[model samples]
Target: MSAIFYIDQLPNRTIDHDGQAYLFFSGTAYLGIPQHPDFHQLMAESMRRYGTVFGSSRNGNVRISVYEEAESMLATRIGAESALTLSSGMMAGQVVINWLQSQHYTFVYAPKAHPALWHAPTVTLPQLAFADWTAQLPGQLSALSPGPVAILVNSLDAVCSDYYDFDWINQLPDNRPITLIVDDSHGLGVLNNGRGIWPTILQKSVDKPASVRIVGTGSLAKGMGLPGGVVFGDANAIQSIRQTAFFGACSPMPPACLDAFLRADALYAEGQERLQRNIKLAEHLLLPTGLFHQASGYPVFFTEHDALYANLLQKNILIYSFAYPTAADRANTRIVISAFHEVADIEWLAESIFG
Candidate 1:
């Protein structure tokens, strides 16, 4: 049944289904902060400070400072020269692709990039085995493809949530003139001790003309429990996006969300610890179910997919089961765990799925 939520979906971490409260295990809020007292206060204070929407053009002389301030936090966290927030992570990707194509960049896609990325002029390379990244992807990228090449890759494959290694990105041959167009929507604030991996990647790759340049985009709506999208890179790339018609026409993020996000550093750190606990719980819960760990913020797919989906719901627990191109098998079934879940919630899901 189609339903409307009485609360923010992911942060609330509980769903009202059939007049019963079901533990919500369906969001990408790896650092679940919505239910936190601090988050509630932050949101309320934000509403008081900035009303609902800024609704002003950032291109104009006058714009919201929170925009830049929030972007600053994002850039600092990811170690980028600058950052921009757009309507969605997809918009951020669109901005990157548009700017790169305008600069004569061709596209090479890593396997299972989000469907949103395929809209660009892209060639899908054969799926390289995980280890092939250091050995294989580099060779492919090194080829003198026509024009500047943009390798669009997911830091974590959306299908099974496998983290693509960026460590070797710094090791690319100096002759390999490539820009890493990375979609980090899944990994930000969810992995690598809540700092994420992009900072390391960007820091490791220097600013030499022949060395690789990294442009990363992601969703704040997921792990950060906020609205809008982020694109961070060198000053030139961020400037290019700011000058675009897309930036001019798009609405800025809600002031309240930005306000809350700016004040959420502590909440995020605490939530990350809680999320780590939940991850461990999920690991233990599913250990005997024959479904191995896929990556952070998600669970594995197995023969128990159908039964577990129903059984978990019957036990007042809810996990998402949907068809995306990236599903573990052809089935597109999976489980998601969040910081909102307690040890009891994990235990309940385990018993329901395994029993």
Candidate 2:
């Protein structure tokens, strides 16, 4: 079987297909805003205010004030000096990488780093676990000639529900300038009380010299429930990226989404609280079974059980199950808990799994 299922409507806590409704425990909607009535209402209202799309280039003569406003709000929320918004998370990374590449810095990538951070056509990643890669980074960086180096990595290993330690970043030698690019698509709006790992990374660099620079990029689609992406860094770095033809040439994110985001602070807080409660409930119910891997405070859980998907489907439940990154890779089956899931929905899922 191809392991594909199609449905007409978006999946939130439940998915309906072929006249059957199934408990949906999949997708990147950790905050569960897809079917959120409040968010929908906000979106509709924002559309009335900003229109569905702002079809002009960011560098055009007439500029929309909301982009700067939203970027400032995002920077304040994430504890960054500045922020830039884009159409998607992937473009956010490419925009950064494009600017960094122009500076002629040597690129060092972590194992299985997202393709958005890839700099060249023929790049090869080290065949090692993230821990092994982190442990060896200092040595590798020290070996390189003292010039410029860009280190790329993710805030968390989303595939296997693992969180990585980046204490090694602060311990690196300061002989060369270092730019750390973190793809926090899975971390922003979900980790560290919704501030994400930006604050933690800032703390790590507090004692370090000015040679080390940090840049955070990610998709707001997951936890934020926005169909856009963002980049966070110092003002100078952000200005350089903004000047690039790439940033100016690409279309901007929907003005309506940014408008809604600016006004959704209370709504986001409510969703985050609900998501935390659901995550705790799921941990209590599912962790003892020893059938999954998870990170503390993260909503996604993973299991290697090939039968779990079909089994859950039989019980009117649907989880994410598929080969990822490539067809040769082993299929990944995960159970994703969201804010939209009620206590009763979780209890039902547990009963089905345990049975």
Candidate 2 Cα misplacement greater than 4 A, ranges: none
Local error of candidate 2 at residue 241 (angstroms):
0.8
lDDT string for model 2 (279-349, tens) is 99999999988898999878988998868999989998998888876676688888999999999999998
Error of model 2, residue 75, in angstroms: 0.6
RMSD of 2: 1.4
Model 1: residue 293 alpha-carbon error in angstroms: 3.0
lDDT of 1 by residue, 213-299 (tens): 878888877788777788888888798789987688777778788889887888888888888787777776686677544654443
Collision count for each candidate, in order: 0, 0
